[model samples]
Target chain A: MASALARTTYNVFFRRSSNYLVGIFAGAFAFEIAFDSAADRLWDMANKGRQWKDIRSKYIQAADSEPADDEE
Target chain B: MFTRAAYTTATRAAFRAPTFAQARNASTQAANGAFGADRKAAAAWFAKAAAGSAILGYGISNYVVTDDRLAPVTKAVAESMTALQKKAAEYGIEMPFTVAHAFSTADHGLHPPHYPWDHFKPWKTYDHASIRRGFQVYKEVCSACHSMEYIHYRNLVGVSHTESEAKELAAEYEYEDGPNDKGEMFMRPGKLTDPMPSPYPNEEAARAANGGAYPPDLSCIARARHGEEDYIFALLLGYCDPPAGVNVREGLHYNPYFPGGAIAMARAIYDEVVEYEDGTPNNASQLAKDVSTFLSWASYPEHDERKKMGLKTLAISAMLLGLSVWWKRFKWSYIKTRKIVYKPGKFDEV
Candidate 1:
């Protein structure tokens, strides 16, 4: 069973060296995307109430209710 | 005939085939044709073998990296790294880490506790109402000793007071003006342009009045100190009896929050020290909180605008991040998914 699995793996990924190179490049690209998104999510969770997203609604409501001032 | 015979003999000697003995002797000489008769073919074969080995190495590496058998190992490593990062964030361990200064038991004072100020969060702005009350506190209490030399009466407009109100507040104080026609200085009512007036003319006068301990300017005190607003709030109410075996001088008061467990400025804020115009409680803690917030605003006048800009920046960055991620994937999809198949005889025919 191990020999058969190895033969299949070689045929799929290593028969041509270009196939292996392409697979590595694709895997790295996918990993980068996954890691970036996961890190972003973790950061958002950790700083839940401190971020602007958490208070944006309240800020908008306050702004809408109050008369606009001339001051920048 | 004699010259021709000598020339022929010399040519024969120079071009003669090696004898058996000479060939054996020349065996140790370097070979001239190390690459053999077809050097190009030998080099091409070596290049092909090197390329094949390199491809084999890349294939082995790719297989090892993507192996499902090592998933748990990779997962554990990633988890541990993230946990360490989380711990660092929790402890506020900034880069170029240094140990916190240790206080000696002989004279070290108490460390102030962190207060949850309304504006403590990155997205939060100063409580304007509290700032207005803080201004009242400063005007009534701290201004007697400390000068806000960097603050002008006009700065109050649209922040804590209206234009007319700021003008009126400025008019309450008197400032010395330039020489008159008689070359004598004259006094004029303060204007919007004038800085907040100091209680004393100079540092020496201030020191003489306050028993050699001149009150520092409060304009930048919030930022100058280690604890900022938290230290100010604690110091205002930190006064207490000295612990056992400690001696406070005649002029100095014992405040555990102040460094060395003693401060020249005595307990300034007390219950009902100043009445608030908005009918907020006149307790000592509330007074301390308001004044600390005011001082924080004094130190960072751009606090609200900075937070607002931060929110805008974060929002824009989030949008750009999403768009760039999508754009990158879209651009790479065709190259990543396309398959190339070879027809053996077609290239030869071409």
Candidate 2:
């Protein structure tokens, strides 16, 4: 269903009367990627890597524990 | 009308007895044999029996262990629980469950209220004086039982203490050095590069010293524990006598802040516990607050750095978003605002 919709959207963009629609799609796609990365960077800057369970693993209790059965 | 009646009669005759209503029911029962009335009634009876057995099992267990008249154990437990509940009332709250209570009786992950911090924010930094005083509090009080394994002497160079001060602090402890030519290990004075050493040599020794409860390391514990710094501060000061009814174990102490309303750690601080060189008041609360801040820094030396970078990133992202919007409007306006008009018969000439 989604692929069919995308095909229709691409067809509309490449058509002569709505040719500028292609530029808009390309620009929107690029902007979305850039915006996502910038948001990720902001989160990283504020959170300081403390919100992860792995960070808790650095504590003494976690260090003293035995490895899980599946883990090497 | 005659044809309809004939059809009904024909349908009824194909099933059991030729009576209309009985035959209709018989036909339905034959059609839905697997899911018929008898089968449904049997399933209902089985479900009812299962529920009855579960209720009976719970009641029997409760009678045997809790309210059992076989021994006076039930009375003692109830009396103790009632006393604990009353003691909890002194704090204007009561614990809903006890340590002896089954896990199924209570929900997990009971968090204290999230008290906000004035300094520990994404846009703010630690109060440096608090951090410094907190370190002193640790050295004087909490350091007796707790260890900060993740903190190193060098980690305090810029955040809490100067390089010379940190070095002197490091020199106070002895760390084991590697085997020399004789292949035997020896003790050496601690260096700035070394991590803070554990108080007891091993886990078993630490547990033995503290009645089978090893004191947890304080390193990064401000970040590690839920409720964060505020919870720690409250816990340090929340210790009190166990009112009338609660029975604390021989070694345990009453601390409402602990999950079970009892903790192995006794109250470690009193009024004027540690004298501050900077002449800050040496009250119990002040020490607790300062020590909590210091532990925060130990757990998160990168806090200030992260806050600074966060502010810069927020400003840059705002500018980028604004520019992107402006550029988007600039590029799309021609197509968006353009007006094309046509008269009904005038287009042919054009």
Candidate 3:
């Protein structure tokens, strides 16, 4: 019965819906890419008050405080 | 005619069990199932859209709040300007009188609001009082709009206040937040214990408040404007209506003294913007005087050290110039006397 439901007739019945959903998914992927890029640039520009060296040192110190990750 | 009854009976038997309506219903159900599945897919897609929008919103908020990349550039510019000033001096040239002018017309780069360097006519009442007034104004008014996020709480003491005083001042505001019990997150009040809080929660708030005007940080505004208290004073005072029949030049706003001067901060502070706690008048000149003094103090908070350094530099340079002049005279005389002394064995004979 499952095989029968997945037959060529299924494609004919559902092709329009599948295409519509796939297009929406594609749009979401593109939108996320553009949004991430813009967000990165804006964050870079706005949080520029701290000196690079200072921020780097801070991050390094912060990272040092965290336990090392051990993977099998 | 007797066989017709038999044919009708055969037809009834063929159509007895399954009706034609049932076949039509099965087809409609298949279509409806497909449509329902599509609607579910669409709903799942919409949920993803909502999640993506949330992430994007978070990203934008983070971007608006962060000022991560400006520090290096600011430091580089400061170092470059210092080098240029020294080089100019070495070449017997005066560096541009105003930092604003230099920034506006520097051969190196271009920025908007391009008022030429000519706006900087040197008016030397270059004193410290004006800076004190500016500080007062800052404490009273401008600080409300602008936050010196780059400046440390202790740096205020570097200006004039004592260490204890600075500490006391630092104790005023609470900072944002840190890890809470159970290692969770939450907002906390800022303290003078913390660095200055950004006035706006984010850039959007800043833009929204000032009609898209970025009221620049006053921490380095005085320094960036070439350490000129008078120019700062003049600009503060210059925000006035242009006089009638005095046509403002193209690409310039009407400032009587600012060279090709135009400004966007719509004449913010008039003569009597606020009353001084002390006996100082709230008049324009008084406001200008106080604010200028405040700005000067801000520009050179280590005012005494700067003055001492200036005096020392002046004394050394003048001494060198004088010594060079005297050395030249002495060399000329020595040469005149030694003309014959260089004649072989003349000194031995003497």
For residue A51, model 2's alpha carbon misses the true position, in angstroms, by 24
lDDT (10s digit) by residue, model 2, range B178-200: 89899999999999899877778
Task: Sort by TM-score, best first.
Answer: 1, 2, 3
> Largest lDDT belongs to which candidate?
1
Candidate 3, residues B1-350, lDDT tens digits: the string is: 53878878987775454334443444344433433545677577779989999999898767854556666778898888888888888989888742554344323211223232221212122232333345567666667777766666555442333344455566666665657877867765444356656678776788788766576776666677643555666676665566665565443445543544444355556666776644557777677656655554455555544443454456557968988855554444423322243455545555
TM-score for the B chain of model 3? 0.47
**Candidate 1 residue-wise lDDT, B251-319, digit = tens:** 999998877887899888999989986688999999999999989989998987676657656765897
> Deviation in angstroms for B23 in model 3?
99
* Runs in model 3 lying further than 4 Å from the true structure: A1-72, B1-130, B180-195, B225-228, B242-267, B270-273, B302-304, B317-336, B339-350
lDDT over C-alpha atoms for residue B45 of model 1? 71
lDDT, model 3, position B86: 85
- Candidate 2 DockQ vs. native: 0.05
Worst 10 residues of 2 chain B by lDDT: B104-113
Which is the winner by TM-score between candidate 1 and candidate 3?
1
TM-score of chain B of 1: 0.69
